[model samples]
Target: MPQRKIAIIGAGPGGLAAAMMLSAKGFQVQIFEKQDYVGGRTSSFTKQGYTFDLGPTFFSMPFILEEIFESSNRRLEDYVTLKKLDPMYTLSFDDLTIKASSDPEKMRQNIEKHFPGYGKNYDRFMNDTRKKMNALLPVLQNKHASLFDYLRLRSLKAIPQLEIGKSLHDVLSKYFDDERLKLSFTFQSKYLGMSPWDCPGAFSILSFMEHEYGVFHPAGGLNQLAKAMAEVVREHGGEIHTGTGVKKFILNGTRDISGLELDNGETIDVDDVVMNADFAQGMSQLVDDEKRRKYKNIKLQKKKYSCSTFMIYAGVNKPVDLDHHTILFSEDYKRNVEEITKSKIMSDDPSVYVQNASITDPSLAPEGKSSLYILAPVPNNFSGIDWHKEKTDFRDLVLDQVEKRAGLTDIRKNMEVEEILTPYEWEFDKHVYKGATFNLAHNLGQMMYFRPHNKLREMNRLWLVGGGTHPGSGLPTIFESAKITADLIARTYGVKEEKA
Candidate 1:
């Protein structure tokens, strides 16, 4: 029998993992990435002797990556070194600061020191969430390709734990009396780029995952994980073509993708195409309107997207006296979130996340210098805010807040090299739909079977593996998306894979 050939678009984590798995299973795999680098948003860049991760600083759920490497008969540690952070991050409110620790007892102690009476609630929250995670794990690990799959026993059993109508804020309010403490637990909703008050209750598991599994930093940067996956793909005889972009999907009749037309004027016939590109953007750009029944341009515009981000990657000549991660909440965080999600506007006092990675890994910056990654969530392109005009003032405003709140007092004076990325760049340069960095929102209305399936419903022999598809966004879920898609393809060819 002839070997089946698979072509993957975008060399992001999902695409790379899919390539690794399929190639290991004796399939001919090729990945085409538009960017010159392998990792899409997860890729790293070097400027003026300073290295910075383009996106995703937080590395949790290492086991998921380990599983992917193991599938190819390799070990992750051989390719990447991971260091677990002690105080995972420092969370700052107006009058309080909490050093979030992964150690349950230490975290409880810190909570007691800050909130006093709420310390015991930490145990209660962890205990209950463990059950929720157990119930939801099976559902997430499997596929929800049809209504029948949605009604399966495992899915039905996990529904109650889903917290059907409650928001993440509502779930945390049950445990902590102080609103700020609740916000500490719920701020993780922003990982999905959604407001905690609006993010669904089941997502409270995000915080649980962090506190339970602990956060990590790779030796160089999180971008190393992407490079590692790409390496594994090559070891398994997969072809990865960087600086290559897909022009459009060559369709057969209206139901199948026969091949891909490349930007370089090259054409490759393949048995299947795995789309790891941003779902909305890829559908609009690569597939004709008449070819897609479910994700047509008109329908896609109506779908809810996650918020965009204003990013600053700076290289400073002096050391940064901060932890590996620090989250600075605005004085009026709720209103700030409302501005980003509902009003569709940038906030004057926006919450900011700063990563002083040099404190954890010196390889990112030259000796006696530091690298800083600052991110502030803002409205996506749908907001119609003119980023070109607002970029300078917003950069100063964010830096001022970081200097005052995050203790980066001399950031401006010590800054040696810098890069600012607004929503405009994310949309135009990165090809993210509407510059929604986290892709589609994970609202209950758009999750599970409602989210795009791993196997593309619009075209046969085509698949999707990314934040845009199930189980959902974030590094771990995106990795799981790759696993699910690869498994589906393997099953179609009678290739058996070990169960996770």
Candidate 2:
């Protein structure tokens, strides 16, 4: 029999991963990425003896990723080395400094030292998060469903106990009474791209993963992981095509995906298709217009996209002594998110997240200098804002925060190369919906069965695997999404793909 031809659009971690897994299963897979390189939005850039991760600078859930490699009878260590960060991050706020550690006892001790009754509560929360994670991890590498998947977990019985109806803020308030502790606890929902007040109750899972899994970065920077992943794909006899545009999904009258057309007006039939493109943009721009109205009339509260960031990627002559990761939140945390969701413009006193990648991996910058990526989530372009005029204002505001928080007096003159990545760029360049990094917010109604499915409605042999798809965003989640999609395809085609 002719090998099943699978066409995956976008060579992101998800698409590349799906291609790698399926190609190993003896399915013919071709990955097309519009950009000249892979990693979609999560890719990197190298210039003048310095390297910078263009997006997503962290990785967690190593086992799930290793499972993908093991499927092809390969080892992740064989392709790349895993480094555990001793101090996950330093949380810097105007009134507080917190050391988030990978060590459980140290983490709990730190929390206890900062807030009374925090020690035991933190430990209990960690254990709970682990249980929730363990319950969820098995389903991570498989296809998704709504109540059915949770029903499969009738024994864990923590489903209702886990609270699927409350907001993250409501849950955190019930657990810890301290404001900073509450902020620390609820910050994990930032990964879901929603305000703690608006995120789903089950997103409490992030709290579990954060404390249990801890935060980490690859030694060679986040892109190092992507390079390793691509290497694995190439080793498995899969082919990747970059600098290619997919014109449209070619379909028959009944909505079966027959093939895909490229920007050059060429068509190739395929057995299956996976789209890693922005879900909203994909359906809006690529689908048949008449079919587009279906998603429009649905009345979904449009996933409250994560705050779009205004990032300053600068190379400086002197390295600041910050951790590999650090978050400098605004004094008024709730107000910052308000500007993002409601105001839709740059905030006056913005919350900044600064990463001195050069400190973690010296290889990221030149010998005498360091690379700094400073980010602050601002409103997406919702309230009729203009980026051209606001860019300078946002730049100055963030600089003021950096100067005060990092204790760095002067930076503009010492900078070697400065590149700004704003929400406008994200919308135009990467086509991110509302320029939001995590795709859709993991709100209560938008979580679980509420998130977009692997299969599009009224579309067959068509699938989606990315931040916009179910199982949500982040490197590990998207990578796991690829595995789940591959398994779904395997089951549908009856190919178990045993270790070869």
Candidate 3:
């Protein structure tokens, strides 16, 4: 029998992982990434002797990536060294500061020291979320292609723990009396680019995953993980073509894709095509409007998208006296969130997250200097807030917060090199739809079977893998998306995927 050839579009973690698995399973795999590099948003860049990760500085759930590597008969550690951060990050409120530790007792002690009576509830929260994680594990591990998939025993068992109608803030409120403490636990909703007040309660498991599994940082940076996956694909005889992009999918019939037309005007026939590009952008651009029944441009316009971000990657002349990670909440965080999600505007006092990665890994910056990555969540392109008009002022406001609240004093004066990425760049340069950095929102209505399926229901021999598909966004889940897609394709070819 002739070997099946698979063409994967986009070299993001999901696309790369699928290639790694399928290639290892004896399929001919090729990945085409428009970027001159792999990793997409997860990629890194260097300037003036400073290195910075383009997205996702916080790495969690190593086991998922480990499983991906193991599937290829390789070990993750062989490619990148992992360091578990203690006091994972610093959470800054108006009048309080909490060093979030992964150690249960130490975290409890810190909570008691700050919120007094709320310390014991920490244990209660952890205990309950552990059960929630277990119940949801099978659901996340498998495909949710149709409504019937929800009736499976695993899905049925998970529904009770899903917290159906409650928001993440609502779930955290049950454990902590203080609103600030609750915010500490629920702010992780931002990982999905959703406001905690609107993010589903089941997502409280995000904070739990952090405190339980602990946060990890690879030696070279999180971008190293992407580079590593690309290497594995090569090691397994899979081809990865950076700087090449797909122009459109060539149809075999009304229901199937038989090849891809590249931007260079070349067409490659393939047995299957895996789409790892931004879901909305890919559907709107590469797949003809007539070919898409469910995700047509008109329909996609109505779908909820995650918020965009205002980013500043700076190389400073002096060292920073901060933890590896720091989150500074706005004085009026609720209103700030509203401004982003509801009002569709930028806030004057926006919440900011800063990463002083040079403290954790000196390789990121030259000796005696530091690299700073500052991110402020903002409205996506749908907001109609002119980024070209607001970005300059917004950048100053964010830097001010970093200097005053994060204690990175005189940062502007010490800056040696810098790069700024606004929503405009994300949409135009990065090809992200609406510049929704986290992709589609993880609202209950858009999750599981409602989310784009791993196997494209609308097109035969085509698949979806990325934050845009199940299980959902975030690096961990994105990796799982790759696994699920790869497994499904393997099953179609009668290849049994080894259990991780």
Candidate 4:
């Protein structure tokens, strides 16, 4: 029989991960990325001699990444050097600042230092949530193609611990009385681009994983993770075609995806096609509405989406005193969150996240200088705010907050160069649907079996992988989505895993 030719759309982390798995299994794999770069949002760029990660500054759960590399019979250390961040990040509230670390004793001390007598609360949270994490971890690792698949024994056993009807805020409130401490745990919901009050309780594990297992960073930048995966794909005989934009999928008789047509006017035939682009964006652009039963544009519009981000990359001529990561909460954080997620309006007092990587790794900036990555959450395109007009004002607001709250009071004056990316650019330039940078919201209705199945139900020989699909967003889960799809395809084709 001829080798199964698999065509993957986009060279994002998901696509690169899938490519590694398939090529290692002896299937012919070809990945088409619209940009000349390999990592999509996870890629990096350099300006004025300072480097910046396009998206995803830090990673949680190194084991998932390790498993992917192991699946290809390779070691992760060979590709990228990993470092565990000890004071993972600093959280700044109005009255106090707390440094979060994975060391239990240190974390307890920090909690007590800030919230006084809250050490017991941290202990209780860890003891209870660790069980939930173990229960849900295996479930996320598997494929949920149909309702029946999700009803299996493992999932059935884990159901109650899923925390069906509670919000993350509600869950954390059960332990901590102080609002700031509660906010410290709940703020991780932003990884899903969600407000804690709205993000599902099951997702509370997001913060637990960070405090328990720890967070990681690659030596050069987080984008190196993607670059390393791309390298593995090539080592295993896969081909990645960058600067290739897919126009649409070629279907036969309305059900089977035969191949893809590139925008450059080229057509390639293949046995299978995997979508690694944004779920809503890819479906609307590649598959015609007549063929889509579940995710037509109108229905997609109705589905809740994660909020977008307004990013600023600043290269400074002077060194700044800051941690590897810092989060400055807005004065009225809840209101700010509501404004972004519910009211669908820009917040004048937006929460800001700053990454001062130069202090940790000198390679990102020139000697005696530093770089800052500033991100402020904002409404996705659904807000209808004209970013083109608000861009300048928004940048000024973010910088002012950074200077005021982040302790970089003189940050603006030392700026040697800067770049800004608004939600509009995410939609128009990056082809993200609605500029929802984090993809679909993880609401109960849009999760698990209800989320887009790894195997596209409406069409054969087409699969989906990435933040837009099941197990729902974040780098670890995104990697799991790739593993799930790769496993499904491998089983279907009777392909055996190669021994290391």
Candidate 5:
């Protein structure tokens, strides 16, 4: 039999996952990335004695990846180092300072301590959410099988009972009535660039994975996972060409894609193509005018895109008492979201997320020092805020907010070096689509099957993957999106799914 020839564009988690899986199944897979290295949104860089994940701070559903390697007769632990986060996160509001834990009992205890009578309610909510996750994760991790197919399975008893109708905001409200607890539980929606009020309740399964399955950080940094994934792609016989951005597809009037067109005007042939990019960019640019028009004319929310952070990766000379993840919010929570979504810029107060990796991963910095990535969400590029002036202003504003929030009066002086990432930087590189970081806001109409299909509507030999697809955003979800797209391709190409 002739070898299957396929091409995967965008070497992020999604693209790499698809390539590796198909290659293992005797497919000739080639991966093309625009940058000098793989790991699109998840890529990182080291500058001035500090390293940053560049994007995606938290890790969950790593088991989804473990299965990926297992199918290829490899072990994830042998290939990469992963550590469970203790006290998963530290979130600070004006009046509340919460230490979120991975242990369910410990979490219940903390809730009880912080909000009286929340323990039992939280326990029940967690139990139910875990059930939902049990049903959902497997579906996302392996493939995009028919929804009707899952309906026949017995374990998915939670399928119809999972309340897909209500928004996550309303679902949580029904269980825990406390304002702060509700705020904390639903904040995960932000990971999808969606507001809880409108994002589907099904996304709350993230609660089960992050809180129950737990969050992880690879040994060197989050980007270490990307490095390992690249290794897996190579080991499985996939070729990755970075700095070779795909400009478009070379399609024949037969309405079949022959291959891809490079930005430099070269064309590479392939039997099949998978795109792990901004779905719109792939359709509008890669596909010709005919097929691109078939995509659901999805409109982005006019509501301002999420704030693009002004990140300064700092190596502080002093060991600041920061956790692996520290989220310090501005005075008012509602105002913080409002300023970004409604007002569309840095408000009088802006929330901050600061990561001091050296606290746990000391290798990130020298002895007696800390390496920090400070992120302050500003308006995305489309918000009409000028970056030329606000860049310095926001950087200083971040330092001031940290000093006030942590009571570290001279935090800036302790900095050994700094590398900043402004919104413009994100737009220039990640195609983060106006710096929305999480891609095409996971709003109500753009979620689940409602999301852009893993298989393009009009194209026969083409498919889609990455943050913009069904499961939507976050590193793990992107990986799952790739797996679903691959499975769909396999089935369409006559590869029968393994039966139990």
Candidate 6:
């Protein structure tokens, strides 16, 4: 039998997942990535012998990644070395520090120390969310092609656990009396780029997943996941063309996409095309404006989006005593979140997440040197913040906050190399829409069947994957999106395995 050809746009985790799956199913898979390297936002770069992950420092939900590799007859352990973090992360509030642990008993003890008499509430939270996650995780693995599809058996069963009409902050408030304690769980909403007050109650499972399954760190970096998937694709006879980008999709007639025209002006035919690029960015440039009704450029511009980030990757001359991961909350965290989400302005006090991977893995830096990957949540490109001018000042602000809050006293003077990625760069250079790194917001209006379909609604033979699609963002959901799409494509083509 002849192999069917699939062309995937972007070599991010979503694209790489689909490539490996389809290739394993005996299809001719080819992935085109704009960047010189694979992994899109998940890729990494080195400076002064120090390596840094471009995005996504936290590696949670290891089972999702494991499932993908297992389905392709590959073992994840063979490709990437994952070390489970015991005190998964440290959350620093203005008045207290929380040593977040995956072990429930340890976490309960920590809760007792910080918020006395609150350990029982932590137990209650775990019990409640475990049930919700059990019902929700499987439903997320399927594609919601239509309203009817969303009402399927699995989703129907999950409806009761959905915790609709409440925000994450609202849900956590029921358990914790202290606002800072609530912030510990609610700050996870930032992972989706949504304000905790705006992020849905159902997403409280994000914090549960971390405390339940534990967070992980790859030996090199989180970016290693992409390289590992790319390796699997090649092993399965799939081709990955990095440093190559698709200029546009060629239409057969009106709604049928036949092939892709490369940026280099080379045209290639495909049986199907999977888009892993940012939905708004890809749709605006790749599809004709006239044909796009739901995700038209004007409409997309108006949609609620996740806040962008200001990133600083610095290789310090000396090592610092810090946890593997640390989140330093602003003095006025709620106001800071509001500044990013509602005000759409840079904040005077920004909540920052810093990863000292060198402390966890010795390979990321040279002897006695460490690399610091710092991310500060900021307004998306819609804010008109003039990052070109503000980049230096923002960097200084981030450094000041780090030194004051995180106790990294000498971060400023010891920089061997420094790289900054602002929202402007994310949009203009990285092909992200509005420079919203977390993609579209996870509001009720933009979720489930309302979100961009796994199967392109207007165009046949075209599919969508990644954070922008159904099930929503984060590494696990993005992987689930690819699985859902791969399953749909396989079913559509009536592809079947031969019985032994």
CA lDDT of every candidate: 0.94, 0.76, 0.93, 0.92, 0.75, 0.91
Q: Model 4, residue 320: displacement in angstroms? A: 1.4
For candidate 5, write residues 1-500 as lDDT tens digits. 22878888888888888877777776788998988988887788876656677777888878888877765556789978888998888888778888888898888888888898878887888888877776765555543324564554642654664576787878889778866777778767767765566667877777767787788888888778778878877887889999999998887764688888898888898888888876655665666565554452343333224446677788788888978888887777667776776567677677788887778888887778888888877677778788877788878888898999977688888887888888788776666667777776666456555566787655667778888787778887887787787777777777754421
The digit string of per-residue lDDT tens for model 2 on 422-459 reads: 88888888877767777877665555566777766647
Q: Candidate 6 has what TM-score?
A: 0.98
C-alpha positional error of residue 83 in candidate 1 after TM-score superposition, expressed in Å:
0.1
TM-score of 4: 0.99
Choose 1 or 2, whichever is better by TM-score.
1
Write one digit per residue (lDDT tens) for candidate 3, span 1-500. Answer: 22899999999989999999998887999999999999999999999899999999989999999999999888998999999999899999979999998899999999999888888899999999999999998999999998999889999999999999999999998899888899889999999999999999999899999999999889989999999999999988999999999999999877778899999999999999999999999999998898789889999999999999999999999888989999999999999999999999889999999999999999999999999999999999999989899889999999999988988778998998999999999999999999999999999889999999999887898899999999999999999999999999998989876533
| Residue range 159-204, candidate 6, lDDT tens digits | 8877789999999998999998999898999989989998899999
**The 10-residue segment with the lowest total lDDT in model 3:** 491-500
**How many residue pairs clash in each candidate at the backbone level?**
0, 0, 0, 0, 1, 0
Which pairs of residues collide in model 6? Answer: none
- TM-score of model 2 vs. true structure: 0.94
**Could you give the C-alpha RMSD of every candidate to the true structure, in order shown?**
1.2, 2.2, 1.1, 1.0, 2.9, 1.3
* Residue 443 error, candidate 1, Å: 0.6
| TM per prediction | 0.99, 0.94, 0.99, 0.99, 0.91, 0.98
Superposition TM-score, candidate 5 onto the true structure: 0.91
Residue 13 in candidate 5 has what lDDT? 82
Model 2 CA deviation exceeding 4 Å by range: 138-142, 145-150, 153-158, 296-303
